[model samples]
Target: MTETLLVTGASGHLGRAVINDLLDAQKVAPANVIATTRNPENLADLAARGVIVRAADFDDPASLEKAFKGADRVLIVSTGELDLKSDRRLKQHQAAVAAAKATGVSHLLYTSMPNPEPVSPVLFAGDHYGTEQAIKASGIPYTIFRNGWYQENLFLALPHAIASGKWYSSAADGRIAHGARDDMAAAIAASLASGSKESHVYTLTGPQAYTTNEIAALVSEVTGKPLEVIQLPDEALTEGVKAAGLPEDFARIIVSFDANTRSGRIGMVTDAIETLSGRKPRTLKQFLEANKAALLG
Candidate 1:
């Protein structure tokens, strides 16, 4: 009997990329893979390709158990919700873990963040930290992919900055080790599809660190447009985001990321990506050049 691998959050970008890597790069048989999501219709193409598509909602224990049944390995993609005060995310994660355990899955893999300290200002780190602790206490064989910041996050801020010729941020002069989202996904897929026996925690990061100024310079160089990095007070940054029509809570969380980046909390670079994926990570310049047209327009 072939071992079945179930991947949650299959409709999202990272999840879909992992599925593709499992099939295209790892040569995993599609018949032995299960792609799951809350909405099953989103995975029609996967189902048509002989891959099992199941409906799995973290909020519903029965759904997760059903989705996880007959699975040897499971990858729990972290949910997108960032609200923790209500404890909804915690409940969802707990539900997934409980279902995995009850369904007798052999190996459990989780997508987590590089949460060195629990008190770091990164808003979503706490959720990952809590989930990691839960997985440890569960006594199930597991692997934790502690992913670092994504270089694409800069693109989210680029369009507005390019339009105004100024990149506003609270990351004054500090650098961040931002890895590509696809690299992180590929690492997770490779580990899951590998024959490794022991459980491990892989800290996925980029090979080099770059500051906001350096990133802005890359944008300028790629687009041939002058761009200036403007450092702002954290409170002012939060206020500016709110003034631009973002929710106060969301703006505060984004500004807090700047504070964390500015304090050198996310500045550490590592060779983990190359070590795991056996290929050098895409550099900031490469990323900028590839996405230059989108960044400028």
Candidate 2:
């Protein structure tokens, strides 16, 4: 049976990758996929390829209901709003869940965080937890993918650090199983294509875990740049990032990742990616090597 797969946030990085994996790699028929975004024009190529492209805004419930219609499985990619002052992201996720329920979607998949705890320093943890609760309460058979931090996220800080020959962090010997975003998207694409009825929770992490110091060493090896990991107090770390011209919200997010790592909340290593996608997850080394040119600049 060819089932319709509705992927929200389709214009974004993860969403586009999942759709591509579904159509090109997973061999899911393009006609069976629905790619929804705020601007359908962004997905014109997908539409040209026979994939159904729909306009669905997270803030627009009626559009979500329309876009989700007739979908067998739907993936509600978590919204990117990080302003803790507002509940917009949670409301958007809630809207997606409600739309899925109303459309009678067979199974729903949600991109979540690893160990979404209320007390965690990761500022976005609560938003993911709340979304998970809403999915459970929706009485929908679902797959919850607790995606680990993206190895590509290193680009946010690595270039600047390499230039200065120092990597600043407050993680204090903490490790992270940073998986590649594309690999997680592939896993999600595979799961959606399988059309299985079982409800499962997967903690998707990298093939191996690495500490901040270890990553710094790898950077030094990869780029021949003597990068030193500077351990700073949390307050000092935040101030440093802010002084480097990062917005306070983003600076706090970076610091919180370290704080969460120090607490051992982001270091859970798992084989869930291979179990789901029938392939080993990409290593941080592979990711770094592939993007070396970009990181060097």
Candidate 3:
């Protein structure tokens, strides 16, 4: 029997991209793929394409286990819940890992960020670390992909910066290797469909790393939009983010991203994307060039 592959959070950008690549590029039969989300209605298109769509709530273990039934492999896309007090992100991840184990998944995969070790400044690094530990302790074969920051993440900061002709940062001289979200998704889909039972961890990143200044220069070149890179102290950036209407907790998290970067924790470049997907991950410049319009706006 062909392995039944299930991807959780199918309604999410990464999960949906993975499922699409699985069908269109990896050539995995739609009949053998199961897409799980909280709202099955969101994946109606995939369902229409003969993929099984099941409602799986990470907070509801029974629902997750039922949704994962008979799956030979499963990917747990990390949840967005970052409630520090409740530690809901780690709990949700643990719940998913438990459900995957209970349902007897042969192989498990997880999406994690680079340098989720304790020393990382990112407030939510703990969530990914705990999830990886849980997946390991579950006694199932697993692949942990420590995904790099998405090139698309620039959308969060760039559009505003471009409009004002100023890019402010606390990531002084820090370099980051940004992988295109879709490229990362495609690579993940390839690995999922490859049916490799080997349990291992890999870091996926773009072929090159660029500092904030370099990224800004490239953006300036592509969009003909002049930009000035303004460096600020971590505390100042945190305050700025807070002043921009983000919650205090969120501001801290945003600042910690720069902290992590400044500490040289997120600049690792690897060939894993090409090795897995059989294609080079898009360069940051290419990503910028393609999304120039989006960046300009």
For 162-273, candidate 1 gives per-residue lDDT tens digits of 9899888999888888888898888888888875657899888877888889888878888888889889999898989999998887898889788888878888887777
Candidate 3, run of 10 with poorest lDDT: 80-89
Candidate 1 accuracy as TM-score: 0.96
Clashes per candidate, residues 3 or more apart or on different chains: 0, 0, 0
Model 3 misplaced regions, further than 4 Å: none
Q: What are the models' TM-scores?
A: 0.96, 0.98, 0.98
lDDT of 3 by residue, 106-149 (tens): 99999998889888899999999999999999999999999999
Give, for candidate 1, the lowest lDDT window spanning 10 residues: 82-91
Instruction: State how far residue 286 of model 1 sits from its true place (Å).
Output: 1.0
Per-residue error at 67 for model 1, in Å?
0.5
In Å, residue 246's CA in model 1 sits off its true spot by 1.0
Model 3 RMSD, rounded to 1 decimal: 0.8
